[model samples]
Target: MRHFRISFLVTFILMAVSGWWGYSHGGMPGLINALWITGVLGVMEVSLSFDNAVVNASVLRHWNEFWQKLFLTVGILVAVFGMRLLFPLVIVSVATGLGLVDVWTMATTTPDVYAKHLTDNHAQVAAFGGAFLLLVFLNFLFDDEKELHWLGWAEEKVNALGTESLAVLITMGAVAACVAMGPVEEKYSVLASGIVGIAVYIGVNWISGLLEEGEPDLQDDEEEGAAPAKNGNGDLVKTVARGSIGGFLYLEVLDASFSFDGVIGAFAITNDVVIIMLGLAIGAMFVRSMTVFLVHKGTLDEFVYLEHGAHYAIGILALIMLASVKYHIPEWFTGLSGVAFILVSLWSSLRYRKRHAAQA
Candidate 1:
């Protein structure tokens, strides 16, 4: 509650301003409609992204204050403006060979045409976003080092394979199938986009791993109650220099991958770009604030399996996005499915705690 005071107040002000702006643009009825749409979209984003918040908190709990603050500030800006606003235009501009300025003008002056162009290339966007997210899900599933298992025997067997690249193999096969099923003209572009997605995920992880490798073991610092005066490799860098930056970048890229669908789906609600921006902005802010709440409240420590649930949801979402290239699925279904997974995982965690207490 204390952590979210500022966010709640800001949320109120933003909603009011959003409503008034809606009224100014669309008159009294439009005012009412705009406010309704914004609120709904905000709720939709929160529902769809509660798993995102949990995953974010899992990453954030490891960071020091500076990195956490950077996530709230810089990361939120990227989620809102960078992915929400600018990313859409970038996708349209690249697809249509239009200048950025021209795309912006089209979005404002001729929204329907802009939307057609946007939706026209949904397959490529889905392929890219889906490929990146599939890798995220697969990597977690195939992690030989992950000790906790929700599906004990199956997970154990999968983990036992111990091969570092099996996840990538499966993901590559999935991408190839999707590409093959796509139109002949789109095969090359689709395959290339997916490869780019895989490459970006690999590149980001490699860079982050390289940076983190130089940092001393965190458990050592916890035992000593001090950051190392010197890092493991005898580098001059401060302890914060390595892990924090790498972790921040990793989380931001993860968030960007998570957000790709939400941003694309926002157009279904309304064609007015400003309304969509404000609506999504409101949701993005709430997610940031919710993450802080989770970290400060130690929710992850209490609800141990919550992170597992979130990842499972990510896996499901990845499959859905891949399947969407062949079949249309509603955004509501995606949001609802994610919420259902989180709820079931929460129940499982509570049951585990109760049984452990009885044994004690």
Candidate 2:
């Protein structure tokens, strides 16, 4: 109860600050709309990002107090800057060869037109992102470890390009090339953007795995750094340690991957970039909070298969993204469908818990 109160107060403060800022710039009506839009976007983002929380909890459980703070503090900055500011710019740069300042002007001035143009061409983006996520989802289904042979193969072939960092750098270069030459040189090559997105995802995962191996094992230092105290039997208490900052960052990257479609799709409904950001940011915040809530409460243990459902949702979303790359499904339809899947999965979790309790 105490935690929940603090969470609500924090959320309120942040939203209020955002409202004041928006109001100062755009007047009362603008502030109200910003509140309403960001509010709505926040709800949608939470729902859409539920799976993200589940995934994050799994990774964050291992982190120590220091890195955990860093995860929240630094992670928030990364999300705001990387997703809110730079991401849209990246999309614009890829779509049109415009400078960042010019893109910002266009995004703010004629946001509706910018949104519509992006929405109109969403199929390609969806297809690419969808395909990549699908591959990730399928890999989870088939392989337990989810290793990236691509990077490993590169390590063998090219001495300099073999490093994990180099692999990602090169992959980004390829993505830029694909975005540039692939579409312009050959009209059919527009599909290359999503391919690049997939390649990037792979690179990121490989890099994360490589970096995660560097962290000290938690069990080794558990005696010196146990959590505050356990209320009940130790079974329910998670051993806290500084886990992988890289792991959480990787999760954020995946969350961004999931966001690509939603961000573009949101534009189809309305063109206000501010509205889009407001809504999406709000949604993302809720999701992040929910993730922390679940972690703190050990909700995953309560609902054993909740994580599975989320991964499945990720799979479905990935497919939707891929389809969007080439097709024109209604934006609302994509969001609602994922929502439905998650609901069904949640229900299953409840049922599973009930059955187990009855047997016990």
Each model's TM-score, in the order given?
Answer: 0.92, 0.73
Candidate 2 structure, TM-score to reference: 0.73
In terms of lDDT, the poorest run of 10 residues in model 1 is 230-239
Please name the candidate that would achieve the greatest lDDT relative to the true structure. 1
Per-model lDDT: 0.81, 0.62
Lowest lDDT sum, 10 consecutive residues, model 2, at 233-242
Residues 69-116, candidate 1: write the lDDT tens digits. Answer: 778888888988898888889989998899999999999889989888
Residue 33 Cα positional deviation in candidate 2, in Å, after optimal superposition? 3.3
The TM-score that candidate 1 achieves is 0.92
Question: Each model's number of backbone clashes?
Answer: 0, 19
Candidate 2 error regions (>4 Å): 1-31, 120-124, 143-191, 215-242
